[model samples]
Each structure stands twice: as C-alpha cells, then as structure tokens.
Target: MSAPEQRFTPVLLTLPGLTPTLALEILPHGVTLHRLFVQADGRTHDLLIGPENPADHLTQKYTNTIVGRYANRLPVNQDAFPLSRNGHSSTFTPQSNESPTVSLHGGRVGFDYVEWTPLLDPSESQLFTDAEKSHLNGSDGVVGVIFKRISEDGEEGYPGRLLVETLVSLVEPSGPQAESVKTGSELKLGSVVIVYRAKLLDEGKVTPINLTQHWGFNLDASLKESLTVKEHTLSIKADHTIELNNVGLSTGSLLPVTGTHHAHAEKESKKIGEKWPTSGYDEFYVFSPRSTPTLPTRVPVSEFTPTSDLLKEIITSEASSKDPLVQLASEKSGLRVSFDSNQSGVQFYSNNLTNEKNGARKKIHGGSGVSGAGDSYGVGSAAFLEFHEPLAAWLNPSTIGHSGNDTLLASGEIYNNFVKMDVWFKSPVA
Candidate 1:
C-alpha cells in the first residue's frame, strides 16, 4: 500500500433554512444524499428527482438510504423464526428473493418504508434509537451509533429471542493518502471512509442470518442516451467458495459460489470457478478469511481489472469509477454489515437492469441536479453497493444439519456489527 498525501477534513453538510423536516424521509439513517437543487444555462435540475410538493409522489424518489435492524433478506420472518440478536429474536419473511422462503431486504417493509423520528443538529441528524448507539472509540473524531432491535418470541416463526444493534461510525481517514478534496473527479483529493459496524445480541439458540443493502446506482455519465455496463469490467478476489443450500440459504451451510446453484448456472457473468471474464463481471468473491481482531488495513480489498497502482482491488476493472462512473462494491458491501462478530461472504451486483425510462427516479415533470439532467431519469445514477456477513459462507449442511450451525460458540456468542462502506468518491490531489 502507498501512503496518501492528504486527508479529508470533512465539512458537515446541513440544509439551511429548509425545514429539518425537508430531510425527514432520510432521517434515522444519518446524512441524506440529496440531489443539490441547481439550475444552470437556463435549465433546472434537482439532482434528487422530486416535485414541488409531496416528495414521495413526484418525478424523483428513491434515495439509497441506510436500512436495517437486519438488512437484505433474512430468508425467514421477523415474526415466526425468531432470531437472537441483542439477546432476543424474531422471525420475518423478506422481499429480496424470487422465492417466498427467503428473507429479502428486511421482509418487505424493513426500514425503507417506515418514517424515522428525527433528532436534528446543525451538521448531522441524529437518528431515532429505541436506542441505537452513539460513542467515540479508539479515536476522538470517531463516532459510533448502535441501532438495536429486541424481538418478542415467535415473531417470525422460529424459536428463541432477539436483540440486534447495528453500529455505524464515521472515522477520519489515515494513511499517507488520506485526504480527497474532490470526489470521483480528477481534482485535488482526500479520503473519508464512512464505516458501519454491527453487533448482534441473541437469546440462546442458533440462528441463520445475512444482511446487506439494496443501494442501487446508475453510472452512465451521459444524460441523453442510456448505457449498458456490459462493456464495464470486473474482477473478484477470493479464491474459495462456500456451498449454499438450494434456496441459497445458509444457517450453517458453507461453500463457494462455484456450484450447481441456480445463480451460478443461470448467470453467465457470475464469474464462478476459475473462469474470469474481462466483461459481464457480476458476482461475490469472498473477502480474505478473517477470524477475529482483523485489521482493516491487513484484509485484502477486492481486486479490479486494468489494474491501477492506486486501487486495492481483489478484483480489477477496465472501468474506473473516476471516469465513466463505475459502480464497484466490496460490491454494495458498500452498505458494510458485520454480524455475530464473524465476517463472511459479500455480494456484488452491477446495475445491468437499470432503465432510466422506467426507473425508481421517474419524473413526468422532469428533474436533475448533482448527476446532471433535469428530466425523470437523468445523469450519473445511484449504485446498489450492499454488505453483509453471508450465511452461505458459513453454511455447511454436511457438518451440521440444514441449520448450518457449525460454529462452536453456541447460541449466545458475540458477533461484531456489520459495516457499511460508501464510495470515498476520491478527488485528485490527496
């Protein structure tokens, strides 16, 4: 690794005059990534794609906000299959998978739809916590938040109880190359990493869990014509695979992504086995194995193709987020997630399915701002960089049952919180 030249001295962003209420839809999560309302050359573009009124129903909608208690899909229900986090548990079916059996992105309503009670400050908006956590650890500028969910028995159908807390923090980036003055552009630079840490407190029973975000993004820089990312390149770093069950469920089944699994076979771009592709790159390569007390510096980040001396890719890319706006994740490991203190597999999906004409940010009247266009589906779109300690990595049915509880820690062990990472959106100088 090389030493960085500058570090990002983060300037807290806050809305002036606009009601702390304007940012309501984004609260409880932390900072809101709003489309800066701007009009240049006699044109108007509100990067956020919203209307003059009722923001939800307007031309612009969908913010890649923070979500959880548990993210992605649980493959069960928060009501029936009670999970054990924070010493209690619940069960709930999710909406992420094609199969009803999978808990996809927090059982339909997870945290996305609901309104979060806001506690506004000048620079940062403190979220609603039935107590989520807040603190300073190891570093003074470091601040941590704990979002906990205590479940009633049989809330999702499974047994045992649950208490879950996801801790998210902002730390000053250190290193010879720590500062980015501009982001995702070739200007003066600095680096600021937004870290999300999670800890689960569970009751006495084994539970199968996976969490990541659905933060979708579009990287095509041109506003007039939609682009296909097939030409974009990708590379995954992990060499091993964890065998998952038929439903891709992993309470305790461990294996690699290289198998007869539907995803492996159905998706050609999945990059399974040793066959690497210069194009159509989409798949999860396991992060280097980390048992515990792992240093963030030591773990090998994913690699990319068209290798650059600057990037730490387990995977590599011809596509540079610096130009043409590539969307790489640890792949949405972008929404970093830690669990039971155990680190597992992370998934990476490209927005091959993004349709500006028919997207979540549709505008009839039109919209556009930070990303450029003033119409419905404008420039530089969002990316879905998800994160989670995959159960698939730990699920090994042969060792245990389909339950896949092969770990010896029993039901009450401690799992470090999940971590959410965003694009540092690097600038030039640092």
Candidate 2:
C-alpha cells in the first residue's frame, strides 16, 4: 500500500445504532468526502472538511469530488450545442484539455479525477422494522457504501457509455424519533443518504448527464484560530438564480434572488461573513421544475415528516416543499447542515479560487493540476452545494422560455440523482 498509501485508502461509514456517534469518510481520490464526525450535545463536532493530510484533498480543485460527465459548464466554439443521437450531429466540445474558456468540471478527466470501486455491506441483523423504527430516531442498524465507476464512451468529452453509482448511507435514529433528532427538539435531522445513479451504455445514442457532489463544509474544526466561513449561517431554498456571464458563464438569465447582484442575492438567513467582499458565490440557484412554463406545479416531494413537537419554524424551513434545498449553520459551532435535492440546479460556490496564487488548478480542457498557497484560501474558506441538471437545462434549451424543457439523455433513459444530508447541533446550550 504505497503510492501515498494507495492514495489514502479509507472508506468508513459508521452509524449502526447511532446516538453519540456518527462517522463518515469515503476517500479514494475523487470518491472524496473526507470525514464528518459528530457526537451531538455532549459536543464532538467535526462536521466536515476534516482532511489536513493525505494531500489535503489537493487544495480543492474538486474538493469532495464526484463532479460529472457534465457537472457545471458547457459551450465550445461558436457557443457549441446540438448533440443528435440516431441522426448523428454532435457539437458541444471541450471534452477536457483543461479549459481556457468552455467545458469546466467534466472536461479535464471529469468524474472528479477518477478512482472508484467499492461495494461494502457489514451487517449482522441489527434489525429495525416497526416502520423502520419509526423513521429512524431510535438508532439501530444501517451502514452502506457503493462507489462504482465507468465512463468510457467518449470519456470526458461527453457521449454515451456511462455507468456511475454512488451511495453513502449511515442511518440509525428511531427510538420513537430519538427525542426529536436527539434534542434539536423536533425535525432538523438526517443520518445520511446520498444516492446518485447513472446508466446509458449507448443503446442507440443520446447523452448529456449532469452529476454533482463537490461538498465542502467547514464547521469550525478549530485549530486555535482561522476558522472563518464568514461565521456561517445561510439558508437557500432558492427564489431564483442562474444568470451568470462575465467569466462565470450561464447567461441563460432567470434572475430574482430578491433582486439579484449581491452575489446572486438571497431571500433570507444571510450572514456568510456578510455576503463577502462581494464577488464570491458562483451562481445557479433554482430549486426544481425545469419547464411546464417556469414550473406550474411539479415540485412535489415533501411529505417525509417525522415531528414530535418543538418547532420554531423548524429553523426557517426552505428546501422547496421538501423543506431543505440547502441550509447551513454554525452559531459558533452549534453546527447545522441540511440539503435535500432531486436535482434541478444548486451550485453555490464561495471557495472563490482556492488560493496558492490560484494557479495549479488547471484542467479546463487539458489535465494535471494542484499548485498551492494563495493565502492558502480566503473569504469563508470552504463552501459549495452543487446539485446538478438545469442550468437552463444544459446552457440553453431555450433558456427558460421552456417548451417542456428536455436536457437530453435519450435512448431508454436513466440518470438518477439524489442528495440528502443532515448534521445536528444548536441546542447543546448555545
């Protein structure tokens, strides 16, 4: 196990009868998500960004990796577009030379730098039925891990031949709702669930898959000082976004985040160091619905309730009906993170160029990167919430003029997406 100890091999996921224990880490370069320890009220907190070794996630080029076959940007030569299948035609270049203008995430060796293949299952009964122990709040059983990969076809340039799958479970919370998620009082919980499947082995052509998992959170794992994520405290179920352009791409318009431009505006829950020196946040908000004329009811996916009392607006709920499109908290380490997605846009990056003079992050279309120290990283330090599909359904499916918006993946179709995470704290006497 050399080669940097086989590239920091360590895939843990403990949560079997969780209560004061909640571990997470699935790293093998690109399957990334380094660590997430938690221990609730008695206070433990390591919520995320727990990697300082193993090359420290190579200074964030795709930090918690898993990027895409088309995660973020796309548009090449003469604003490329058009990928006909059974009739041939293809044109949406920049497959990966490292980028100087177009295809960002999924061009240069896309799938987050590659390296996957792990299908774990460590069990011994640890049963749970009683309606799965009343929606896990009791704490008894569940530990999963499935990270397979295979992008062949046209590799990063984008085409058919794809087969990606990722599942990182770790549940156990159901003793009659474990005192409402172990005393947050009632609802604001998640043991962990991140599924994302993809399959399209060219049964006749037609491709365009967008996946995301650039998870980067830093809940003050303190090391004396320097733990500023601008003091953390944000909530976004999206009131509208995706309007970039000026070197950030996405000019398909669709504004209104409460009057745009303040880093793409935000309706409430503010305070990420007071919205930064201004030019941070990358863009793309919009929760669901890609058509039916800008969303005329088709946002259904809520009812997963499991309350018990103790609701102060459940801490400003908003993930679009399902009530958790994205919410981050850190009232001085009382940690709180919630994100739910069926995927229809949710970029939000504020790592703003990862420092070390910014160089060494190449791969816009080329390959090989990882330079260093640009103050090691500034403003907020770490922040991202990618969730894919619908940046105007791939650049411009009429840019939201919507005609039953179709982001292509044709032939038999199947390119699933899932993102649900929950971490607690905020009543341990803060």
For TM-score, the strongest prediction is: 1
Clashing residue pairs in all predictions, respectively, total: 136, 29
Error of 2 at 43 (Å): 13
**What 10-residue stretch in candidate 1 is worst by lDDT?**
1-10
The sequence of per-residue lDDT tens digits that candidate 2 reaches over residues 126-182 is 111123223223233556566777787767556667766676666554335445434
What's model 2's lDDT at 91?
50
lDDT per residue (tens digit) for residues 353-418 in model 1: 334554333342233422223233322233244544443222233323222222222243433323
Once fitted onto the true fold, the runs of candidate 2 whose alpha carbons sit more than 4 angstroms away are 1-39, 42-166, 171-195, 207-234, 237-252, 258-335, 338-344, 347-386, 391-422, 428-430
